[model samples]
Target: MSTSTLDLAASLRAWGVIRTPLVRLREIEPSGVAIYAKCEWQQPTGSVKDRVAAAMVARAVADGALPPGARLVEASSGNTGIALARLAVMTGHPFTVVVPENVTAERIQLLTAFGAEVVFSPAEEGSNGAVRLAERLAADEGWVLLHQYENPANVDAHAVTTGPEIVEELERVDAFVACLGTGGTLMGVGRALRDVWPEVRVVAAEPPVGETIAGLRTLADGYVPPIFDPTALDGRLLVRLGDALAMLRRLVRTEGLPVGPSSGAAVHAALRVAERLPAGSVVVTVLPDGLERYLSTRVLELDAEEAGGLTLW
Candidate 1:
């Protein structure tokens, strides 16, 4: 690796993107069944995507795919874009993010704050449209598209960092649960946990078909991320928007954990898995991001009647 890439790596470490806390949710689950969450929101950018962004950039730089000051582009709902934007600033790379127009205002502001050019895809088309548009723009402008959905580094990031951290903290993880976006977290961490406990169940919590959760997707929604392997998962749970919202509020009010919607979906699924497992079973889940990004959207503040009509971005 070049000196610049080395410096970038060092900067990432200095910025505190590595080794988030694996905290047990003592208040959220039964005493017999233990539930632990990887507090990824503690990352510098307050999202698990920070790890992916750092790993992707490092690998790209090392591979010479991203030479010094090369422009970077990506499609994100929010977290990944914000994460890569911060890294772009550190590396002196011009960054652009293609996002769905329906994304929260806080996300757009954060991207702009990091000096990233933001492009909006049609709101109705959702994130898939953003992905398509980003690909076209990257092709036309010759920008480096760090497509997180298919990036091998996305999986490698969790495999090396997130997975290892969980293994080191827990004696046995009978089940691993996470929200399914690009499926990198579940795939990578599931593989790692399974290596130690071969029977460890890997489950995904995804939104139902045609419904949208902030950072999760149903495989039935026409785009299966290339890095996702169905064989890696033991099961998939359909978490409704209301259920995720309710659980998000529960995590905040009951556990005092300010986590995002995806984390809510993850914990919802984790609870289901925990209920079915034996008394001594351990369940681990990933809290992908923080609640700050969703504040403008008022997801947490929605009343039950208002929540019924809520359209998720």
Candidate 2:
């Protein structure tokens, strides 16, 4: 008889799946703020969602939601698809990811390489289009949808892994900054940190109201992830795609951190928070992913009003 298969989380950590550490930086001071970045983009799948995806698929297997040979389906910007696909390959499940056509080719190539079938939505409509299409597919096909938008596993991943790591590394974090996607990372991490220090502020960095950031959709675009509890945040701010991209450059040049646009937004927001706080207030930011995944867009360089009208944003 064959031995029982290994549990996904245990196997990963046992195999030395790297843990992202909190790296503290010299005081970019605003009186109460000391900036730190939890470089989660450095995770195995190149994004913080890797934790969410792993938790998601593993829970599905245990709960019988995703049976052996069950087909998993969902929507993504880029990083989520990549994360889910990598984990699906690990758990021996078949998955189909729906994404906007405008996402980075690196994301598509990585998803395909990891054995996920990708369906592209209309480019101009962005992630909103992908969301509608994915919901339609799930309804018609009755596929097991690991809806990251509302997935509790997404929040739990941050609560368990990301938040604790930050707390362990810092004596006191006065403010936490996160890129607002489906609001999972921010809400989850914010909740965990607040439990220890209720006064610690949580800030969200969102794409400029009408614009898209990475492959994420927004509340105004007509959907909110069920996992998102808006009251979780202390404040929310918008970041322009260009400003975010520029901050990525500064991060690499000034700090040697090559993170993605969402991460850049966090940094930009963190700096803003830093400017308003008292000296020595610990400010921690979660950078969800890296820039290499968006190389096709030249997120580092730009010309005219549009980058390339594709990956540029």
Candidate 3:
């Protein structure tokens, strides 16, 4: 618990809350379509979930449900847990994160280092198991449950922050691409884009069944977060883990951006969208996190065959 409230405030200061706009990639080879990335990975928690966590905690506090020093609790798939844990520490509240056992060891270690108490849910069951366990615990103790999967605050994060930032960054964004996890980023940004430019295509980069967070996949054997609406997206594409990893390497090797798996997935989707568009099309992709957290997995070592059976969960 050495991370003081001052540390959180200092971290927040390091990042200007009014996030910078998307930087246009004007230099791709055979440059017809331009691709830009909204670097949410640069957020304090190294995940876009930081916005949602901030929104969730602030909203709860505003509603008088969570007073100062109250405990916040939830189940997470790493990123959200880390964001909320940081929030709890900053807000003078405490938090317990219920997570599946199989999440990246780095994520678990990071969460623990941030002073969040961890409760391991069954890895086989995935995030849903954590959700179920969290629900029961919340019910039992009346904890302030920031149920992100269904929380409107999650959507608001993108709606108010990320969406506008993308629009401001790009001159003419033909399409928006992002990975679909809780569906907040896709839906919120989709709505904003459609409201502003109805012609803008909202592309969802979904993980293949094997690469998804367990129980979080509605297409496979899992539970869909209620907030997810298939019809909300203008387009949906499945990004393979191998192609995603390769793209991640490509970005790092070529563009010097060290992004994580979800960013890789979004970049793959961006390229696919770019392929179909006319010349000079602008495609913007949101990067969820940085690559520093993924080194333990040796993502670069994955070949097509080996990447196939390796579940991203």
Candidate 4:
């Protein structure tokens, strides 16, 4: 690589948005299947969105879309906003994020800590509302909107980095599971994995219609991201909020993995997929973020009744 290219790579690594570990869950082993998780919370911003944010910012800079002192804005439930806030600081851009008012207090606090302005959308409308509000704000204020839902950079980030990392570590992957948000992770990683294991199943774990799981969305709920290709998925598992929380608790208590609700949902789906596969099948899932962002919400204390309902699909 050229000197400039080498320096750029070092800078990205220093920013803590590079490779993360793909670890086997030695304790939570199913009968004949091996399960692994990509521990993405290790990133500086404590979420897998760090990769998307870094890629979007770098693309914006290279394309000259982000001029000197340009303002940056995005719509996020939590992780993406926090990740973008940190990148905005590094790039010397003023940052703003639109989020549902019902998001956890810790998320708001983290965004503020990174000096990003927070705008509230109607909580009842969820993240789709946040996206609409962000679009208006970006247009009104002339802020550069790094729209994760439509941004190719979001998928490209995972395709180039996250997917390759997993394939490098695992010689054969039977199935890849992850939460369905903007669909970037599944789409990007799915494509990469398929390149090696042509028959590898790409599955998505999502909340059922009208249900809410932290950092997850269902396409049945009206808004499907433009980048999402439904044909790419082998299966779409509808995981309930309560079931996801139960799985999250299991990971923390049994597996010693302190991951967020989305991670829990992904693992829950992964296990379901594993049960149908042949013995010795390798199932890998992405843990999008850690538990720290959920501390203020008392997530660990939440019981099944308090967490809503449980259903498997």
Backbone clash numbers for all candidates listed? 0, 7, 1, 0
Could you give the C-alpha RMSD of every candidate to the true structure, in order shown? 3.5, 4.0, 5.1, 4.0
Per-residue accuracy of model 4 over 99-181 as CA lDDT, tens digit each = 88878878889999999999998776777788889999999989999899999888878887899899999879999999999
Q: Rate the local accuracy (lDDT) of all candidates.
A: 0.84, 0.76, 0.77, 0.84
C-alpha lDDT of candidate 3 relative to the true structure: 0.77
The Cα error of candidate 1 at residue 14, in Å, is 5.0
**Steric clash pairs (candidate 3):** 32-280
Q: Write the per-residue lDDT of candidate 2 for residues 134-162, one digit (tens) a residue.
A: 88999999888988887787787777677
Error of 1 at 286 (Å): 0.8
TM-score of each model, in listed order? 0.91, 0.89, 0.88, 0.91
Scanning candidate 2 in windows of ten residues, the lowest lDDT window is 1-10
Model 1 reaches what TM-score against the true structure?
0.91
lDDT of prediction 2: 0.76
Which pairs clash in model 2? 31-278, 31-279, 32-277, 32-278, 32-279, 32-281, 77-215
Q: Over the stretch 180-298, how does candidate 3's per-residue lDDT look in tens digits?
A: 88899998888777777889988889876345444444556566888888888889998877788888887777777777877778888888889899997778888788888877777
Predicted structure 4: lDDT = 0.84
Residue 73 C-alpha lDDT in model 2: 90
